[model samples]
Target chain A: MKLKAPECVFSSAGFCPGCGHGLASRLVGETAEELNIVEKLVTVVDVACCSFNIDYWNFDTIMAAHGRDIPTAVGVKHVRPGCPVLAYMGDGAAYSIGMAETIHAALRNDPVTVIVINNSVFGMTGGQMAPTTLPGERTATSPKGKDPARYGTLSGVELLKGMDIAYLARAELVGVGGMAKAKRYIKKALEHQLNGDGFSLVELLSPCPTNLNLPPVKAKQFVHEEMTKYFPLGEFIDKGGDK
Target chain B: MSKVKLNIARCKGCGYCVDECPKQAISFTGRISEKGYDTIQVDDEKCIACGSCYRVCPDSVFEILV
Candidate 1:
């Protein structure tokens, strides 16, 4: 299947200077199509910056209110029956505002695939903080930097693994190596959803220098360093294994 | 006697290979591809065929015929 034939084009149509979101999003869309999920794809975008992705997508894309993308996707999955869905959102919407929806969806084992773009800070909302913000990280909200003593632990992969979801992975789009592994996880997630299993979420530690107030290169290095320390790279849970 | 291959598209023109070449065989004159990415070139004589370029590229653009 010729997959890049999506309904969007042009670099400006969907990407930041060094945003790995575009790379991961295109791969997901194209891979889903190759796996025959495009025709059945009903992407639910949240109130986060990914809302613009709705306009750039070629499949059934919908703009949902803050933190409600999960239920919206679940609703679409329940009604559409066999249609595959990819619920893409940023950390702010998924881990913070949408936490309730995420938990319920996972608890009920909704047949939906989720693509969580964890750029650490809320890129769209003025580079503020998010639950997934790395420790000792400085954000617009956390101007003094994130204090672990007050915030506690933060790891989306670990958090989701505790949910008992059918498929879950936390990877990065930092480089070609990471992108390659992420592509495999995306393909697997779509198949899991289409096959009528529980929830599948792929948390991508994306780069957002524009928001993070760092150069693109430095931002990427942050993912490979600080971010990877808290979240840690590799498959946190796959087919329900510790590895 | 060995194979040295490359994916020119992935070469980001960083010149990491040019500086690190112990043989001083690699030279980059800023020639870019249709993809607008500057690629690396090899001065075959200076190349000891040690595969340093293969080791350095983050994209793994270099391939050595083992």
Candidate 2:
């Protein structure tokens, strides 16, 4: 069967060719559609590469300040307790600028779905070093590659693994099988929110071909071969008890 | 037999689909797309309709007609 593209997504995503934000955004849209919550979904996106989702997605969206998406999403959830809230952001916003908000939201057990796209660089700002940038990975800011001694890499999922959040997982878009698993993880994250469970986060290891200075295909392979080694995939925590 | 439909107008020509296709049925067209990137074409005879192209494409360029 030919799966229809999610209606919540626009044809022109405004993302560069081979950028993973488009695919990640589409996965959220597809998950919302599958859950029949498209109309009631309220998305709070950070002011980074994830800002593209504010336009690409046809649902009710709010563009939050950089690294402030989680708090904004928490606020939205408080106002519309019935509506499911989704926070979309990149590695810089989630781990660098927004680390405090991200941790506290989990600490407070807020009911919202957070999707962090871990591309290992600041994509919108021309691929600067990010908290998730792998060691020895060269970025614009780290010309000689990231020094693990000076700036250690941080895994968003690993940081949150000890938290009492409802769900925590890392997924990648490396191949068809990986994409399927990514979708499944995203669906589970959203479902946790639908059940009024507190705080679900799915960190997606996505490719950045333009920023990574590699072909679109090679960028994908990098995520599989290189990124996965630092940030493993699989459900770190699952309190949903199987759907 | 199945087919993969292309939306040339929306294609950004990242070539992810071309490289990811297990059957190697897709190739880059010399012509550029409306978005000014090199677009791709699929050889119908070689396509197995595994839907690999549909999953990997950043843009929603491919639709599998099974």
DockQ of each: 0.07, 0.74
lDDT of 2 at A186: 93
The segments of candidate 1 whose C-alpha lies over 4 angstroms from its true place after superposition are A1-14, A240-243, B1-66
True contacts kept of 2: 0.66
CAPRI tier for the interface of model 1: incorrect
Weakest lDDT window of 10 consecutive positions for candidate 2 chain A? A3-12
Residue lDDT tens for model 1, A56-104: 6677788888989889998888788878878899888888888888878
- For the predicted complex of model 2, DockQ is 0.74
**Which residue pairs in candidate 1 collide?**
none
Q: What does the lDDT read for residue A200 in candidate 1?
A: 89
lDDT by residue (A120-216, candidate 2, tens digit) is 9999999999889999999999999999999898988888999998999999977788889999999999888888778999999999998999988
Best candidate, lDDT-wise?
2
- Alpha-carbon error at A126 in model 1, in Å? 1.0
Candidate 2 error regions (>4 Å): none
